[model samples]
Target: SGVSCEFEENPCDSEPCLNGGECKGSQEFLHCECSTGYTGERCETKIDSCEPMPCYILGTESCEGESLSYHCKCLPGWEGNGIY
Candidate 1:
């Protein structure tokens, strides 16, 4: 005689997983697995994917995508990679 099931809370704590998604719950269903570059439905959006947009000559330099590999930073003052 010990049965009590009442689950109607803890849905990512209202965080909604955006920009840096990381919400995972299991009561009925609730998912949000976005982070690197971000996505839609909850992770928001900011996808660069580094698909032909790895800062070659735009605004100095800028390309970020930490998941498959991507790194380039050199804008103010200019330096390496930015191609003087």
Candidate 2:
């Protein structure tokens, strides 16, 4: 006796993705969900920390995060850090 395997193409049943995501087949009847700034169906968005933020004030080029938000640290002589 011989054993054989058969594979079927099953599309996603329910689309539970956000931010322009696509529905693809996964292990179960669920999709791999993808989100903005990410590719593939598994919602693997890459966060680039080097990106510039508008909260930075003059003389300051970057900002740092505290707990739940971020704050700008202006250089010497600068007025505001733009983060308050």
Candidate No. with top TM-score = 2
Alpha-carbon local distance difference test for all models: 0.69, 0.55
Q: In candidate 2, list every pair of residues with a backbone clash.
A: 32-41
Per-residue C-alpha lDDT of model 1 across residues 13-40, encoded as one tens digit per residue: 8788887789997656789999776787
- TM-scores for every predicted model: 0.28, 0.35
Model 2 Cα shift for residue 56 (angstroms): 3.5
Clashes of each: 0, 1
Report the poorest 10 consecutive residues by lDDT, candidate 1: 1-10
lDDT of 2: 0.55
